[model samples]
Target: MANAYVLVINSGSSSLKFAVIDSQSGDAVLSGLGECFGMSNPTMNWKYAGTKYDVSITGGGDHHKLAIKRLVEIINEYGLAEQVTAVGHRIVHGGEKFTKTIRINEEILAEIIKLSDLAPLHNPAGAKGIEAAIEAFPTLPQFAVFDTAFHQTMPSKAFTCTISNELYKEHGIRRYGFHGTSHYFVSREAAKVIDKPIEESSFISVHLGNGASVCAIKDGQSVDTSMGFTPLAGLMMGTRCGDIDPGIIEFLMKKGWTQEQIFSELNKNSGFLGVSGLTSDARGILEAMEEGHKGATLAFQVFTYRVAKYIASYMVTLDSLDAIIFTGGIGENALPIRREILKYLKIFGYKENEAANADARFGARGIITEDGTPVAMVIPTNEEFVIAQQSAALL
Candidate 1:
């Protein structure tokens, strides 16, 4: 078992979430997250093999660099650095360039940088993590597991935007869907739970998190999805104004607002947070709903309405759906939100099983759909496992 570990790094704009797992077994030996990058005394927290390892690191102008340094240090300090085989990085957007797990080389690294503008918040961080890992583990192999890889099965019609051909060729202006890794893993899990072979099942996956999107899986492949050219194009996200009129952006520009301001409003100042004038947190909104808060109610309605509409729209893509699966934060945990979504799904012939719906044990996986109706289930997503599995296969 020489060099049997594989390190998985998922980097965000200001945070790096990492895990070290046994490549042979896919069991995470340690996991950690570093937050508040570029700020002083950022939170560097971790859990190593069942023990909590939380600590703050003071002074960091470049937390990405610091995060990698700390991560290497922790690996060495815990006596778990031995037999480290390779690094598997979660790259957010691989564009149309990569459709599978790829070994990283200078050429691949350059290509990743080329696509950074489209995923400004994520790609750069991914590149930074890759660079730092290469510096530290120069002799080790590294693989990139792309978020957009699974959605590559989407036909041109589903991913192609109604934009100009010149823009498409010049700027890659097409619907490069995100969160594909999550949808991919959860859909397979759903297929298993429904006792159907993946290739024989058709499912609509609703991934509801801070960033939300729905995907339609037909014959175990992604046929269509809600997200467009970016993650901001689908259902109402925590802050992002998903599916807003493009005219609003043009209207703002006419008012003499800078491009930066308009982007900020659509990406940051909208969604449940914007509509409710309350916290973007679903938990907080649900709490307000209990207190008879109208704004919160409206926010919840908007969220569910978009989800239901897309779920129905996606049904057309699937021809006929065998099951509907829920994954991501809100999709897995929010009971009331789940109930509301099912209420609108009656048109799809989804008759919610009240007993199972209210059963807290059904939190992770449940048959929300009534007997003989299309299966509806909850499958906890495991994107890291998918990466690990893919990395192991490469070995």
Candidate 2:
């Protein structure tokens, strides 16, 4: 098994990211992305050793199966297919059935499919990736590493919604946090950086990517999180509206808006894009703000304000905070965003080291607080490594 590899697949709505990691060292032997799936001209971009390649796939552009088959072909071309010992998939939503990493089998496949309704845009595509992996390497063991599993330790008080008992008890409607893999990885890293055992440390992990969420970790367990029931309930995200007035939905319904229209608007048109009427990428918004764009400036203010408020709210749940970690795209980069957030958090005795904050970006890990009470850090997340490690352990 030392010579074998664990292939990790992360299937997104319009992209497929696959990596072949050395099972023993957990280093990526090869990694690539198949992007723009379901589009007319889909492209494949990958890197090996020190070289990079990008090309358009001819016809296999609209399906996960085709994208995966192309990935297997690339692996075979490099003579690395024979070294694959197992396949690990990143499943976004597991409902309540999958509380931890599990081996993929017929029954498990059925359950993953049944859970698709809970995550229409994610689970279905993940299931398809699993099926394709099975077809591509029938002899290899396949595992499902769920994003929701890490936050399953959250107590009921943190997850329970104030809706009808029937809605929650009958249907599984409660806060099921997303980005658990990133949060879990960063929290452990934070504990290590401070030279403390994770099981005895407390952390507030902020994963601020296109999709954002904050988790309150007490003694290394998730006590509460920002995202609820669905990923749309947390902090304002790239395109999704977070924590909005419930009455707005009912009002839109009364105005003759269809459910499909409302759903599309909330999930696809809201958030930074809706607020700015421009783009969802934070880099673009920040650049626009520099150019005196009012909408971009307002969007930036609202986004940081909401994130600061959530971080402050979670502080109440932790008896003693060990550190506050920032990961994901915006969290790792976007120094302006970090500065604005810490400004609102000054009441908590947090003071940012301007030079350190500006220096940390795109995988540079460091502390950004100036000898603060609760340490503030910028640690880039490695979710693929977590998946690979879990898969190898199961094997």
Q: Candidates' lDDT values, in order? A: 0.86, 0.91
Runs in model 2 deviating more than 4 A are 1-3, 60-62
lDDT of residue 236 for candidate 1: 95
Model 2 per-residue lDDT tens digits across residues 210-315: 9999999999989999998889998999999999999999999999999999989999999999999999999999999999999999999999999999999999
TM-score of each: 0.95, 0.97
Model 2 global lDDT (CA atoms, 0 to 1): 0.91
Between which residue pairs do clashes occur in model 2? 175-229
Cα lDDT tens digits, model 1, 1-395, are: 36478889998888889998876666788888998877666888899867898888655367777778888899899887776678899999999999999999999999998999889888998999899889878988899999899899999999888989899999999988888889999888888887889999889999998999999999999888888888889899999999988998889899999999998988898998999999889899999999999999999999998899999888889667878888888888888888888889887678878777666233457777689776777887878878877876786
Per-candidate Cα RMSD to the true structure, in Å, reads 1.8, 1.5
